[model samples]
Target: MLPQPNRQMALAQYRLRARFYDAELAAFEPVRLRSVGCLQLQPGNTVLDVGCGTGLSLELLHKGVGPQGQIVGIEQSPEMFDLARRRVARHKWRNVTLLNAPVASATIACQADAALFHFTHDILRHPDEVRHVVGHLKPGAHVAAAGLHWGAPWDWPTNWLVWMAAMYSTTSLEGLAQPWSHLLQHLGAVQLVPSPIHGVFIVCGKVLSTGSEVVHHV
Candidate 1:
């Protein structure tokens, strides 16, 4: 669990990032597009984009799930949430709903068909928080997360220390592949698949309704 002070700091960081998040993340590029393509999402699926910053992931999730699908985004920072809401409104995404709250404390009201986290893991300050997210997920659901890990060669240690100093520790990531594996195993996800996405590694897995392997894409 992260210290309350640290969580507050992290929220502040995201609030600041919300201003230029779209340009910095470059959500419109093909790299981000293909990152979630393997899921083969269809209509009527309910996708929750946890920690959805500036709503970059929203557009694609909306497109993948189509008009029939529902897209809900949970953001902790009010500024970020405001920015995301504005972005969605500008695009006229009627099915997309932006809720301002942290992933762990946020009330989901309904079980998600699939959940998403893009560049959200590293920012998470503790392991337990991620596990808490899994505990709430419904069986037979799917999760897809893509993000830069600890040793990404971006002065990560410095950034980590800065974030940690504010109160909570940044996620202790091990390579781009570790975050997904750690959460998938903890969540008991079946038929797990891993892939590379630019500066990060992405994983897709299904939560078994009866703890059974479902299907294989490859």
Candidate 2:
């Protein structure tokens, strides 16, 4: 059986990452958003950002959803959560709410127009918990995940950092990308994204439900 991590460990892992999360993902969005336009968004959408540390992506998501839309970001790490909450609050993000909890445990109080589980997928210690993320989805919502693989390059210094991370108890997400496509099959996501990007791959897919509209391969 796959070993699952408790909430405490998960939080600690993110707290460590929060310190460097923004720097690591700085150049990621432009390349990452290549998959965003494919979600076929409209006005008045609600989005769920799993493992949404420090609200780094809150601004972009809010704009994408528009004034009539809403955004929710869930993060388990208290320190990270506090930092994210402060970032959003200081920015006066009226349309956004940040929650402290595991995304898999997040309650679906609101239906989402889209959902995202980003680099966090690789950090998930348990496979079933990864699958549990599906429970929080809204009907026919757009979903995507960005995962890193062996092919992603690291310079000597960063490579050394990666090695140290692997020795740690958490957030050492090795071998996460290879299994990500399996989720596309499990979730029955249509127009699923392709693999083979520079160190990481962003996979896109749509949730299909009644009254289907359109699909994009971003």
Candidate 3:
């Protein structure tokens, strides 16, 4: 069986990477933009940012939601969370809320209009964590996720790149081939957006309403 994600190990990894996390993730900014765009956010919308590390996407998200909207960012690592908090303070964004807790236990008080899970492979692998985040969304709320994934079986060069990046960022390599499987299970009419970068994926979908029927995919 594939190993599950280790929270302690993830915390340790981010603790060390926190200082340079933003710089490290600079190359993936386009991926982040694409993921946030999948939300199709509007003014006054309240969005949940799952595993929001260092608040790199905050400015873009805030622009989409506008001043009337709300943003709730959840982060598990103190080192990372602290930087996110400082970013919010620096920008003086009064509408943003930061939760320094695991996504599975974070008290997300709002029924968000959308949620974005950017490069959150560890969180996506945890069923409980995905369930908790989905539960906080309003019916038919939009959901978008972007992250590294294993390429085609024969694509050794792509797979090698995915492996190296995953080793540095994710706590577990399990489900890298289908990282959005668990999240898609609760979503409806899912659509996979082609990623420009090899070994990466972007998926967008909406929460399934009670008794709602729809097609689902990764």
Candidate 4:
């Protein structure tokens, strides 16, 4: 059986990585941009940033939504959230809201037009967490996710890279082969976009309206 994700372990992990998180993620900045681009946000739209760490994606998301749009970031680690809070404060982004809580239980006040889950493997592994985020989306709202995953069985080099990154960032490596599967359950017309880097993927889809069927395109 796959090991379940441990919240306390994740919290402890981020406590140590928070200070250096942004620097560590520098190489994946392109992936972050692609994920936000998949959202296709518009002015006055509200977007949720799931597991937003140190607000690295905030600038891109803010630019996508513009000053009129709203950005709600949900994070569980106090250390990470503090940096995110400071980032928002530094830029004086009035429309961004930071919620220091787990994604499954965070009190998301708005029905967002889109949600972005960039490199949030642990959150995507939890069905309850994915459902909770999907439940707050407006019908036909866009959803985008990007993260590391196990490569083909013979691709040991790529898999090694993924393992090194996942060990540092995620509490559980379960479901790494198809990390976005749970999130896709509540979405329709899914499209899996290939990333430039091996062992990484970017998925874009829209929320399934009542009675809508799920469709996936590679």
User: How would you encode candidate 3's per-residue C-alpha lDDT over 96-126 as one tens digit per residue?
Assistant: 9999999999999999999999999999999
RMSD of each: 5.3, 4.7, 0.8, 0.8
Show model 2 residue runs off by greater than 4 Å.
1-9, 122-128, 152-177, 189-197, 210-218
**What is the Cα-based lDDT of residue 81 in candidate 4?**
99
Model 3's TM-score against the true structure:
0.98
- Tens-digit lDDT track of model 4 for 1-218: 87978999999999999999988889898888888999999989999999998999999999999999999999999999999999999999999999999998999999999999998999999999999999999999999999999999999999998899899889899999899999777889999887877889999999999999889985
lDDT of 2 by residue, 34-65 (tens): 55555556678888777777777677777688
Clashing pairs in 3: none
Better of 2 and 3 by lDDT: 3
Against the reference, the lDDT scores of all candidates come to 0.63, 0.63, 0.95, 0.93
| Candidate 3 C-alpha error for residue 148, in Å | 0.9
* TM-score of predicted structure 1: 0.74
State the weakest 10-residue window (summed lDDT) of model 4. Answer: 192-201
Q: Candidate 3: list runs displaced more than 4 Å.
A: none
| Residues 72-183 of candidate 1: C-alpha lDDT, one tens digit per residue | 8888788888888898989998998777876767777667777776667543434665665666667867777665543345766744643442222133333333546556
lDDT of 3: 0.95
